[model samples]
Every structure is written in structure tokens, then in C-alpha cells.
Target: MKFDFCTLLASSLQICYDACCTFRIWNLQVSILIFFSLFLFF
Candidate 1:
């Protein structure tokens, strides 16, 4: 029972970590796009 709980916790943490990484990458892409658009406009 304890092992199962530990496994569940570990998996959940890993999922959260992956989501954070994906979000960071997406945010970076958006920032780069905006930067390039503004640079081009000027």
C-alpha cells in the first residue's frame, strides 16, 4: 500500500514537471514571436 502511494506521488510529480517544462517552452516561443514582430514593425 505504501509503495503504491509512493509510486502515485512520483508519477504525479513527474507529470507536473513535464507540464511546467512545456509551458515554459511555449511561453518562450510566444515571447520570441512578439519580439520579432515588434522588431520588424520598427
Candidate 2:
């Protein structure tokens, strides 16, 4: 039972990390676009 719980928790953490990484990448891309557009406008 303990081993099963640990395995489940580990897998959940891996999934969460992946999701966070994807969100971060998306945010970075958006920020870069905004930066470039602002620079051009200014």
C-alpha cells in the first residue's frame, strides 16, 4: 500500500511539472511577442 501511494504521488508530480513547464513556455512566448510589438510601436 505504501509503495502504491508513493508511485502514484511520483507520477502526479511528474505530470504537474510538465504542465507547469508548458505554461511557462507559453507565457514566455507571449511576453516576447508583446515586447517586440511594443518596441516597434515606440
Candidate 3:
């Protein structure tokens, strides 16, 4: 039972970490797109 609980906790932590990484990448891509659009407009 303890082992299962540990595994569950580890998986949850991994998922949270992955989500944060994806969010950061998404934000970076959005910012880059906006910068390019502004540059083209001007």
C-alpha cells in the first residue's frame, strides 16, 4: 500500500512538472509570434 502511494505521488509530481514546462514553451512561442508581427507591421 505504501509503495502504491509513493508511486502515485511521484507520477503526480511528474505531471505537474511537465505541465509547467509546456506552459513555459507556449508562452515563449506566443511572445515570439507577437514580436514578429509587430516587426512586420512597422
Over the stretch 1-42, how does candidate 1's per-residue lDDT look in tens digits?
254645655765565566567786665555555556546644
lDDT of each: 0.58, 0.58, 0.57
Off by over 4 Å in 1: 1-3, 24-42
Give the lowest summed-lDDT range of ten residues in model 3. Answer: 1-10
Cα deviation at 28, candidate 3, in Å, is 18
What is the total number of backbone clashes in candidate 3?
A: 0
The window of 10 residues in a row where model 2 has the poorest summed lDDT is: 1-10
Q: Per-residue alpha-carbon lDDT of model 2 for 1-42, expressed as tens digits?
A: 254645655755565566567786655555555556546644
Model 3, 2-21: lDDT tens digits are 54645655755565566557
Output the better candidate (1/3) by TM-score.
1
